[model samples]
Target: MPKFIVSLQSNADYEAAKQDIEKQGGSIVDDSMKILGMITVQMSDQSASSLKSLNSGIISVEPDQEVTIQVA
Candidate 1:
């Protein structure tokens, strides 16, 4: 399972999408307004990929690629 960042489109149902994600075995990692309407969730990649077409509100769904920051 992988985590993803899901962005919602304008005129989209945020709450509906959130509920749908939970219903489909996804856990909301962060519902914070990353960019106003962006939600981070933990779920299988397959589930996240399919989420786009399943929900009209989804503008984009991308894997939360792990990044290692080097601070010197």
Candidate 2:
């Protein structure tokens, strides 16, 4: 189970992206844009790969990494 930040093109279709992601068992964690244009989601690596194959508007689907800082 990997989380991904799905970056999409400016002219992306929200409905199409939503449908594809949802169909692949991806859950909507946070949507960067108002609709499904830009979003952060929790999904399998397979799902991310699938999205890239089908969605032309997608810019990139990169794994979400956690960052921590030590304050002194």
Candidate 3:
């Protein structure tokens, strides 16, 4: 399963979004970012695509990536 970052719209229902993700066979990986309206989930690519399209509260479903910073 691939990991993705799901972003919700402001004022969107968090619980509803969580339920929707579960319905799509996705599991919440990290919800610590929920305060920022973002959640990390682990699921298939198809599930991510479906969730993004079917959920109105979802702003985006993007693959999770690592960011690195270099000190100059």
Query: Can you write out model 3's per-residue Cα lDDT over 1-72, one digit (the tens) per residue?
Result: 899999999999998999899888999999999899999999999989988687459999999999899999
Could you tell me how far off, in angstroms, the CA of residue 59 lies in candidate 1 after the best superposition?
1.2
Q: Model 1, which residues run further than 4 Å from truth?
A: 66-72
The list of candidate 2 runs beyond 4 A from truth reads 35-37, 67-72
Clash number for model 3?
0
Estimate candidate 2's alpha-carbon lDDT, on a 0 to 1 scale: 0.81
TM-score of structure candidate 2 = 0.76
The deviation in Å at residue 10 for candidate 1 is 1.6
lDDT of each: 0.86, 0.81, 0.92
* lDDT of model 1, residue 20: 87
Model 2: per-residue lDDT, tens digit, 12-44? Answer: 887687777888899988876645467888998
Residue 7 lDDT in candidate 2: 83
Model 3: CA > 4 A from native: 69-72
Candidates sorted by TM-score, descending order? 3, 1, 2
Worst 10 residues of 2 by lDDT: 30-39
Tens digit of per-residue lDDT, candidate 1, span 30-65: 988745989999999888888988756888998898
Who wins the TM-score comparison? 3
